[model samples]
Target: MAKDIPAVAAGNQVRSVAKALMILNLLAEHQREMSLGEIAKEMQLAKSTVYGLLATLRDFGYLEQSPEDGKYRLGTRLFVLGNVVADSWDVRKVAAPFIQSLVDELGETVHLVVLDKGEVLYIDKRECTKSLRIVSQVGTRLPAHCTGVGKVFLANLPAEEVKSIISTKGLSRYTKNTITEFHLLEEELKQVRQQGYAIDNEEIMESLRCVAVPLRDYTGNVCAAISVSGTLSRFEGDELESIVSLMVRIGREISLHLGYRA
Candidate 1:
């Protein structure tokens, strides 16, 4: 009947959306580039139908088409959206217990941070009963060049991206230990990569020392960092080594919860 026209159109629209989602899932399952013909054949849909859905997804940046092979793959927009979802439900929930354990065992403060807009954004912090406490608080931003957690993140980023961050957020000196020169900071980051950890030796605040390790996601990419902080006297000789080793183990365990393999 004529009255059934709108209902039929709505059903068609839902089918189109379902097909589009199926295409995305297929790409994810294969984890490789797929051609239009291949996708159409795999989905058992007509080439024209697949083409329309692919075109829509590509236009919205949900998919990318290679110019050389004309194959399609997931796009950066999906990564951005995925990170937003992960931030809301994954990292913080996964890291909380480990962070608390570190504070309890080490008798020092611990912090979890992520790099945001070339700055270190503190998302969580656990304090010990020590008389001296870190001045930083959760939801606050700090200079990436001067903090141990910040350096761990910056060290993992691309050189060009790091340089861009330095250009935008100049290396303002907080203490004499702060790395103010680009060449020196580059060397510091290189050392961090080689050593698998980073340290802040009175760089941000006088007499405060921090040891930090990077946290990876399921993709094996460094997504965040965790740091243990205390006074200079507490982090020396064999004590510092023990802290570093423990934090590294804790970092790995937290990363595993986020689906990181290694």
Candidate 2:
């Protein structure tokens, strides 16, 4: 017996497949188990049609129906797939092209760093063609209070965690511009969160300025930070605002590639 399924006319997209995906999206949006009738009503489809799609999805492990309530929710398969995606997001590999683009455009050194044990651990660095260079290397660790990248990470931490890091790291002063007091550092962090960026204003090395922004992961957590570094002359006057805007844009793009939504 031949089934009389209607052939979809628009670009070869199967109607059933599209409906099935829509059902999944609906469930995700609701973020709760849904009855067949509820799903059908929300999808504006017949109960029989929605039931068929739900049953197919349940059998395939993409959805689960409760024995008690008979309501459908997302299944462990999505979790497994999510893990696969997370595992593949090597931040260095994901951020490499964006960092290079920043370096090429701004003619400033760029760095990628993560917070490790309450300190900034530099994982990647791209240098510009300028003769005057910022002396930072991959695998170098610095106090989170003095560097732009470090403060960006710290700004996202809980107050207690920030205090704990301060207790351990001691806010060592590298230059006169370095924030050496707990109260002052707290104020600086508050400003970073407010402005969505941080600046190392000759704090770590005199005459070296850097602007940094946070990189987020799928769960909207700040997973790392990226920065553009140059001499105070390069970061001075009108060029400073342009560099800040470009760094923020690049940060968002790189974060998007890592599954961040906003």
What C-alpha lDDT values do all the predictions have?
A: 0.90, 0.89
- Candidate 1 residue-wise lDDT, 1-262, digit = tens: 1122234366554666778888888899899999999998888888998999999999999999999999999988898997786579678899999999998898999999988999998888899887257788887899999999888988999999999999999999999999999999999999999999999999999999999999999999998999999988999999999999999899999999999996
| Model 1: residues with Cα > 4 Å off, grouped in runs | 1-87
Clashing pairs in 2: none
The model with the greatest lDDT is: 1
| Model 2 TM-score relative to the real fold | 0.66
TM-score of each: 0.67, 0.66
Question: lDDT tens digits, residues 61-139, model 2?
Answer: 9999999999999999888986786457499889999999888888778999999999998888898778257677887
Q: Tell me the spans in candidate 2 whose CA falls farther than 4 Å from its real position.
A: 1-89
